[model samples]
Target: MASSFSDMGDNLDSLICSVCLQIYKEPVALPCGHSFCRVCIEKCWESREEDCVCPNCREVFPQKPKLKKNVAFAYVVENIVNVKKGGAGGTGGTESHCDVCNGEAAKRCVPCEILCCEQHLKPHQQKEHKLVDPGVKMEELRCTQHGKPIQLYCKDDGRLMCLMCMGGQHQDHKVVAVEIAHGELKDVLAAKYPHVSQSMESVASQLQQVQEEEEQTENSSRDAEDRLEEKRRLVCQFVNESVDLMKSEIKKRKMEKLSLLGKQREKLEKHMESLREGKSTMDKAFQELEAVSFLQDSKDLLKRLETMSHFKSMKMTPLPVLDFSKEEKNLDRLITLNKNFLEKIQKGPEEHPEKVDLDQNNLRRLYGRSPSLDPNSAHRHIKISQDLRTATRTCTKSQYPEHPDRFLYDPQVVSCESFSSGCHYWEVDVRSSSCWDIGICLNSMRRIGVESGLGENPESWCLEKHYNKYSAYHNKQKTDLSVPGDPERFGFLLDCEAGELTCFGDSRVLHVFRGNFMDPVKPAIAVYYDDDSVHFVHLVK
Candidate 1:
């Protein structure tokens, strides 16, 4: 019995300190011979200034004893710690296992606050109680304020709630059981999953298409650059060749003129030499008393004089003055043409109007504007409302004072508002009118004659409703349109920056006209039938 007790006393448990409950490090013995870790005992006695005591035995000491290392006890403790480490596998997990089966815990019961193994989890789940994962804390499942299990979900607020929370802040909100809410939301997500996946696939396909288009654009840009370089080289070569031809022509003309002048100079010099020789002969005959020689020389001298006089009287051809007027005019024309060509090149390609397919909602939301009719611009037969928002054609022309700005021939009216740049949108309630022309036109549009009609000249573009038929007209060119139904209102979008005039009805684009809109344009309306009217709608942002 003594041997067995001795062996038991030497076990690993005997090396643990009472205060730390860990294997001793730097073990020290007290006066009562009780052993503990040196640091643990020192910390435990720190509060007891006068009565320091042994933690395990509670043996009293009047004064704190000076601690010294118990070398043999520390050596035993180090050996026991190493043995304990070897017994435990090197696995670093610290989670506790089920005490019943000593196996890994599968689930934890929140209400019972117990961990269960697979064998025990079934019975616990059969009770229909909340079973969380082993890693989930019981505190997390409970409400922070009420300290109760969450039972309800607030549908309005979209959050989980306990029973107490449902009665408190979430009482007014729509509340349902947590399970029901989860299942419903999951079903909704499942139903929408295919559509969402299809949308994602479509977006991915579009991305790939865009990438391929970008690659094609890059290749086209490279080809264009090469073509441009070749054109530049050819132009330079043509210009140099032309300049060389011009220089050659100028040199040929100059040589011909010089050759003609040289021949004329030689003939005059030969006639002058003949005159000098005749004068010398006549002087020598006069010095001699020889009548025969004098007579002969005089006759020759007279003939020479006659020839010289005839020659002096004759007209010489004038030196050819190079006529550069035609060349000058041609060069001026070429310079003008070159300047225009360069200006176009500098401006690059014409800006094609952006084709936009926007519904009524987008049109109103993005570029909505309110423009009232201008009574001053209304024709005599077209009566404007008091508020200047409506225009109606009457049977007899009104006796309104004549104004230069008023339309003289056509029963038309222009809006008070004008736009020169940027985008603007407006709508006209034209359901009351069967035959009407609605569009935009420059302020300088003709005020007299049939040319003053909307869409009949270059200054106007309009969508005309001739009774039941519909057509788009601009600059006297008409295009027949296919309309599905009788539209109540006509929406007009003028994108001046893009130089586009679009008319839409019932969210469908009827027609689009594109041109250079250098000057400001105003909305215009033409009502041909008596009592036919159109109203300018006030758009809301």
Candidate 2:
């Protein structure tokens, strides 16, 4: 009975293998009581691993059973491999077959309508097969879905299409015959190829040239930056040197001013000391005079008898008038010294000579130069009389009432006729009774003369007199007019109760005098000139 069961198992295994149609190296039993090689079973499970069943019976089982390798099957495979090699000339086991040629072991060709072995494939392609040309094949190929060959070429649209496409979406589109389109495009592309190639070559060449130029520009820029840095360093050096020089000059000026101030202070101190000494001497002289008076008044009998009763006339010697002349001289010297010192101080530091040294070449490169500031220099000076004398006559007054002291003049508008004939007459008014003088002067002329006060025409014109009354002051005196006509000029002096007026050419004097006991009032004087006459007026408020 055990033998029968073993035989039954063997038969079942054989059927499973035959059903699989392959020798099982590693057999696996399914949950459905079916058996297969492990690879086949795994492949089946991969499709549906959860449902494993027998293909023949459709019987289902709970679990997949892992089967062991069948060593006997592996031996059978080894023996079959030897037998197949011995029976045929290098043919493998009969188990393998070609699908195209059942047992021929070759692929069948439709063009040749024959089964071709490996050795016959090339010959069949070369000789027996009616092969289609590639171009023809491409032209004859039809759309898979529509089964229509492409016909028309749409050059504007850039596409190939069939008659159906033309009738439908592309009906209104422009198209040409395929053959014609191909020929035209071939000509156009042939013609354009040389130009396109030349253009591409030119573009490449330009790109290389631009790159070289950019490199050169970068190098030049670097060189410029280096030069700029050098120039900046030089400028900084120059500025530092100039600043040091200026500082030294300032120090020198400061020392000079300090020295001047020190000298002025010493002179003032000496003058003060002298004034104190003079005051002490005056006090001593007063004490001596008091002592002499006290001796003369004493009363005693014996003294009176012994004393001579004769009254001797005492001749008094005058104390030297306190020589204020020396003081005055010293005071004058002090004034002059102080004036010089103050003027120097007030003048401040002497300015460095203007030395603009802008290099013309450099300045021209920066901006152009202008042609100004290249003219001759002009020199000017003013002079006035140093002497004071008395006004001999009276004159008129000024018009401007606010500045009672200021004198105004209408500029002497000498007509050409008057100037050529060489004589001009003008007048002035003074506003005082005190002693004052005026003189006429010349400007811009080589020859000059005066007629009135400096000893009556001692080479210039001047008038000096004491006018105590307004009547005597008014009477115009006609002394011999010294016509020193090279540029003979004269003016008038009017002394009023208020002030004095002097009008002479460009010179003027006003508000110079008042009465002896009264303070002098400033005079207002004006000069007006027409073609024929010059009038002088003095106004007092």
Best by lDDT: 1
Worst 10 residues of 1 by lDDT: 84-93
Q: Model 1, residue 336: what's the lDDT?
A: 92
lDDT of the candidates, in the order given? 0.80, 0.39
Model 1 residue 262 CA deviation in Å: 1.6
What count of clashes does model 1 give?
Answer: 0
Off by over 4 Å in 2: 1-159, 163-187, 284-541
Which one is best on TM-score?
1
Residues 1-541, model 2: lDDT tens digits: 1122222334434534634576564554554445567777566656875655665577655575555444334333444344434332222233333334444434344454444455555676666553321112332444443657656777767887777777766677788877788677666655665565465555545554666677889999999999989977986786677567656766776777667667766755665565555555445545655765544433332243232222222232333232335535755775697699889989886532221232323322332211111001100111111211111222333232332111122211111111111112233333332333233311111121222122232222233323321111211332332222111122433233223323332232211222221221111111121111212321121
Model 1 / residue 435 / CA error / Å: 21
